[model samples]
Target: MSGVVLNDVIKKYGETQVIHGIDLQIENGEFCVFVGPSGCGKSTLLRMVAGLEETTDGAIRIGQRDVTRMDPAERGVAMVFQTYALYPHMTVEENMGFGLKMNGHAKREIQTKVAEASRILQLDDYLKRKPAALSGGQRQRVSIGRAIVRGPEVFLFDEPLSNLDAELRVEMRVEIARLHKDIGATMIYVTHDQVEAMTLADKIVVLRAGRIEQVGAPMDLYRDPDNQFVAGFIGSPSMNFVRGTVTDGGQVDVPGIGTVPAAGLDAGREVVVGMRPEHITIDPAGDTHRVDLSESLGGVSYVHLLGGNDKIVVEERGDYRSKEGDTVAIRPDPAYLYFFDAASGQRLR
Candidate 1:
């Protein structure tokens, strides 16, 4: 119903600070996702928003009210966690209505809310089944249905699909995306999986070492990352980094990938060149690199090659016939090349 805002939020346990000062705003009906590697504090930040974890410093406002110190029940946000946390003995209908029942809502009101949530989640046929009778995805949907019954101001998902199998993860991603479209509710999701973040988020917050790294729409982050950390982390197969030297003639010299004019950098400076796998083309007629491995997945193939001491991955669509142990040459798109400061790991602009 309303937006959420964090003002210079900080979190610490004892003397160890896990979440540094974080300032973020989630617009009404926006799907914001917090993503990063393990121990990066993405979950900690989401829990802070849910009131499940305390904000050590700064303010958290949900709509117009400051909810930094509010109890989880008073925050008007429903959180679906990594674990299902369902009652084994309760039927799906009962489970969906349990929260309202515990709050002393009338039976009719609970049933009405539960029925609406059931219809939204397509759980009508399984309402009479207990947790023991439902499949993994169904149980997870019931878990989400429980949250939907609360009619909260915001929805928080803490890697809710982490427990599902590969196929179910994809299926639930569609379901969750559709749920957001159907409800138009503000949702904050946390995940270590960038694919989920890329496919689901209206905006993504990338975090590392208790601090916010970058925040933007998925494609924006992928196409124009602020630093090498982001450029490498946001894409699948990761970006390739190779040692390069800015030559006296204002050209960047890279082994195996050839030379490109430097982007206003001083001569004799060292830099790191980044190339995305999809932007690289393998030359079967030339031999400058050796194919370390090759994997074909239907129409797309990932060819891993060893260029000097650097490892490069080349993504080829349709029919790519590069095999392991072949001596091949690779070329990166000049327009897609990214240069970063060798010392600081920041983009060279």
Candidate 2:
């Protein structure tokens, strides 16, 4: 296994700069995922590390070697792209062994590597088939197997599962996770899917507009986000942000929900209160609002309430009897509530 280090990396296209100075250290055998929206430089960063794109400044080190200016083949890294870049004419076995063949490895060694990779990826049964004969997931596995046969010190994936169907994506995700465990190689993956980043990564680097927003374990970012952006981006259904002004008695007065005690906040300061949908519950005896909609999802139901002028979603356990236009009292758990500075969007204690 090999660790990758990027020191103050920068990329520029003539006068237009895309990637700001980025410094990141990916540890050996760790699964680090880069997640962000489209045109956020996630793919550009991955390509830079793979030697496909040149870095305008700074250095890139894979293991102990400085490979900033090295050719793609010279670097001990294998990349799996979004499109299954398999040769249509070649059989699965041939495609998997092609890298080793080009590098002039012994025929027996190439065969052994291909067989091992195929077994690991569960592609053993389709070795003689061409790319067209394989399913989308199977073909993606072949693409991964091709990388594995090269015995790269590090593996880089650029949205390798985006082409597959939803079910196939899940299946491939499990396969990729298992493959990481079995191979024990350092892998860096780039994707826009939060679920993928949360499930597959040992560490996640969240980026925004050419700069990193936050980097930490999935739960760390989810539970204690540094700012509103990280808080809103990391959670499913997203965290709800209610705009309110801090009151004189150390409380935030929502337009219709009345004053919520702001224990640690200074009085008379404007702030945005954030709470996850799942953290809010329906309280029958408390202040109530008319429910606009209720979506039942087996184990839990989400109740959307019209809180005066604001809309609040409450997650209730089991079946909820609330219906449209029915008033239901709802309250947010204090412990899960977060505060952010209204102007800067930074988290406040």
Candidate 3:
């Protein structure tokens, strides 16, 4: 297993800079995920570490070796792409062993490696089957098995599960997590899916438009996001941002909702109060509003309340009978309120 270190790494396409200077240290055997929206430079940064793209400046070190200028083949890293990239005509065994064969490994060694990888991936039964003969999930496993056979120090994945169905993606995600635990190799995965990042990563690096937004454990980023963007991006339903101005007495006045005490915050500043839907409850003795929509999602129901121009989504336990135009009183949990600077979107005390 090997750790990856990036020191002031930057990537440029001629004159346009895509990846701003980024410094990150991924621990040995750590499953680090890079996640963000499209055009966020997550994939660009991963390719740079894989040596598939040249870094315009700074250094990349895998283990003790500086591989910034090294060829992709020379870097002790294996990359699994989103498209599965398997050879159409080659059998599973041949495809898995192709890299070792091209590198002039002994025939016996290639066979042994292929057999071991197939067993690990549970692809032994399909060893002689071609890509066309396998299902999407099976083909994906072959792609991963090919990487495993290489015995790479670091594995790079660029949205490898994006092509799979929703159900298959979940299954493969569990398999990948188990594979990482069994192999204990440092893995860097790039994906736009927040669920994948939250579920699979030991550490998540959140990026935004070529810059690092935040890097932390999944819950850390979710509970204490540095800004509105990170908070909104990390959560499922996204945190609700209610515009309010801080009064002289540490009270914030929302447009529709009446003034509420700004706990742990100074007064006389414009702020945005953030409340998660799960943190808000339908209070029996609270301010009343008309429910615009209620979505029952098994264990919990998301109740969308309409308060004049302002809207609040409250997540309630069990089956909620509240429907459109029904009156309900929704109150946010005080302890869960997040305050952000209205102007800069920075968190406020």
Candidate 4:
């Protein structure tokens, strides 16, 4: 296994440039995830590292060797795409070993590697079954097994579980994480799913508009986001933003909600107050807002409230339930509040 390094990488298509200058380093054996909204260049960046897409400028290095100009086969990386891409006529065992066979390995060598991969992926019983006989998860495991057989230095996954059902996606996520731990291989996974990135990555790279927004551990990005985009994108329920203004005593006054501390700001400066639903405390006794909707999901309930033109969701657990049209008040935890520049969406310290 080897590390990957990108120095000022850029990608362009004819006259239109898509990926801007990107500098990144993936340590050997690190599991890095590239994540963002759709068409944000996450897949394109992964392809650049895999030698599938042409790099418009800058250099790509794998281990100690420069691989920017290297062929896809010579880059020593294995890519598992969203589609299974397995041969229909071949059995699972044949499919897993086909790459080795094509590479001119002896039959015994292919069988040995295939057996090892099957053991890792728990495909011993399904080895004789064809693609038609296997489940979607099993076929993907076989696809992954083929990559393991090649012994690539870096493993690239392009939304490999997108086709699976929710349960299967979760199951495969555990399996993939375990595979990385057991093999200690360097891996780069691309996905639009922030949940997957949070659960699987040792390092998460957040990208937007052909550039990196932030890079850190999943929880680091969640807790200390540098901007409004990172804060809203990293969390599952997304952060809520409300208009606020700095007051005479350095406090921010939220129109519908009460005043909170801003400490140091010009008297009339505009700021966006951010609050997470989970951190808000709902006071049913106080009539500041009205419940617009309530979605009960077993142990947790999301209550949407409306006050004038402002709308916010509050997560509740325990005995209290806020039905539609019920009067309520919400107090966001002062320590948990984040303030951002209204004009630029930049986090304000």
Candidate 5:
């Protein structure tokens, strides 16, 4: 029942407002991720929840307690920062039990809790090793182990995998997912990486400039975004937007490409046709498009195309490959097309 709730939460430093009033409910045992570009206040909001930052103008409730003004130690929440933040002089076991030691925990009790955390993180073998002796991934596990030893009601991760290498990031992502599955604890994670958000989060909160843009399940946001920003931000290769004008009989006229059938819109209205890269294919009989470059990555390739003043990337799978400077016809699937108002950048039904 230890769910986190933020009601009209706002953060500001004097007159410079950063996090606007954000109201959100993170259910118990839910893996909620606050994801957005840098300076979007994702970390700030997480800090506010952790009691590391003050909630300037709203209520923050963790479980049944109103902890808007509570001290960090009294919040009953554990935080794992991006850095390992481990003590170089102390072994893994010592570092993991340091917080409990300072809190006047019994030596036997501390050892028992540390042992359980070590088993969970698979750090049992590295208990005797110092931070400097362990690898980056192992060090991070030590940090997480420290938090686990606290036995807090909630776990907060602030870009915990950003410090790892690409392969280690993947490995740790799997490890964290497994950890959540095992404990089923209420967790809140913050990261700018969309891949991390998509893979790790049960609920994704997309933010922009201190404001919430969208909040939903990962694939839900990817398949049906509320606006153009969410549509463009959630996907790996962003959605392609081509400016066009609505023509006769509710048909949208794409520049450099011919008219496409679109209903429920006024004629002669300016709009942007949104198409995901995966939905578009190279058709020989389709409109001739210029291929700028191709990024071949083993199983798949992303073909970059120059369409008028914009750049569009198409994901090609299997044996299909497009060379640079090749003229190909780009055909977009009619069923998957998305329409947005050109002026407001809002999705059009």
Candidate 6:
């Protein structure tokens, strides 16, 4: 019953609206991630849920209680920010218990809560250590432990890993995922990195330009995207697109490559054909493709090709590395092909 529900929620600054009408539901104990590029209103929407931003229209319900106008502390949620925001003057234990002390909690009660949080985060050994004595990952874990001690109904994270180095970011990602599994609390995380969203979230909310583009399970959105934008945004290296025109025989003819069978589309219509890099293979017998560059990553390689006027990327494994300026024919798997309208970018089928 502690699930979150947004009924046509909206936000505006002055005369300009940032968040469009958005309706969403997040179940209790679910880890949902909001992911999109910069200036996409993902953070804005998250702030509204945190009660840090006012709703220009509609209502926000948390655990069946209306909290649209509630104070941040009254919303039954704890937020972790990109910055650790720890107290340098205090030890980890003191910093974790400071909030409860200020709230008039008894000394023994505060100590008990801090001890439990420290144990859960494996910071028991560092309880007496100051912020300066801890590493970046350890400090971030302390920040999370602070939230855990509060025992909020919902947990909100806003780009919490952005401040860490690449290696620490990966480590923190695993830590946070494991924490979610242990706590089983309703959590909402926001990040611009789709890879984090894919790996950490039970459900993902993809946003763009102040509007939600799509929402679904990670693999569901990856395997069956609703539009070109979602398909292009969800995957690493992105999906390749080439302009084409539909033919009379239910096929789409790319200007540089041959025709591809795409049933269920009208003839003579302008469209864009999409394919993933993994679905493309080099055809040694064909002569219309040229390898522009090859990126070797040990077990896998990505070969960038120039076919006619289009640039396509193909993934190769083992001994299929093609050098720059090498002539190669690249073919896409028709079974995995995607088609979209030229004007609207909507999926054709």
Best by lDDT: 4
lDDT of 4 at 243: 87
Q: Using lDDT, rank the candidates from best to worst.
A: 4, 1, 5, 6, 2, 3
Model 4, position 67, has a per-residue lDDT of 97
Cα lDDT over the full model 4: 0.94
User: What is candidate 4's CA lDDT for residue 252?
Assistant: 94
Tens digit of lDDT per residue, candidate 2, span 286-316? 5458888988887877778887657787777
Error of 1 at 46 (Å): 1.0
Q: Rate the local accuracy (lDDT) of all candidates.
A: 0.93, 0.90, 0.90, 0.94, 0.92, 0.91
Clashing pairs in 1: none
| TM-scores for candidates 1 onward, in order | 0.98, 0.95, 0.95, 0.98, 0.98, 0.97
Regions of model 3 farther than 4 Å from truth: 284-288, 308-310
Model 4, poorest ten-residue lDDT window? 304-313
Candidate 6 has its poorest 10 consecutive residues by lDDT at: 283-292
Backbone steric clashes in candidate 2, count: 0
Query: Considering summed lDDT, which 10 consecutive residues are worst modelled in model 1?
Result: 316-325
> What is the Å distance of residue 272 in model 1 from its true position?
1.0
Model 2 weakest 10-residue run by lDDT: 318-327
Query: Of the candidates numbered 4 and 6, which has the greater TM-score value?
Result: 4
Please give, for residues 1-349, the per-residue lDDT of candidate 1 as tens digits: 8899999999999999999999999999999999999999999999999988999999999999999999999999999999999999999999999999999999999999999999999999999999999999999999999999999999999999999999999999999999999999999999999999999999999999999999999999999998999998898989999989999888899988789777688898999999999998888988899988988887888999987879899998865579999998887888998889999999988
lDDT of 4 at 259: 97
Model 4, residue 42: displacement in angstroms? 0.6
**How much is 226 displaced in model 6, in angstroms?**
0.6
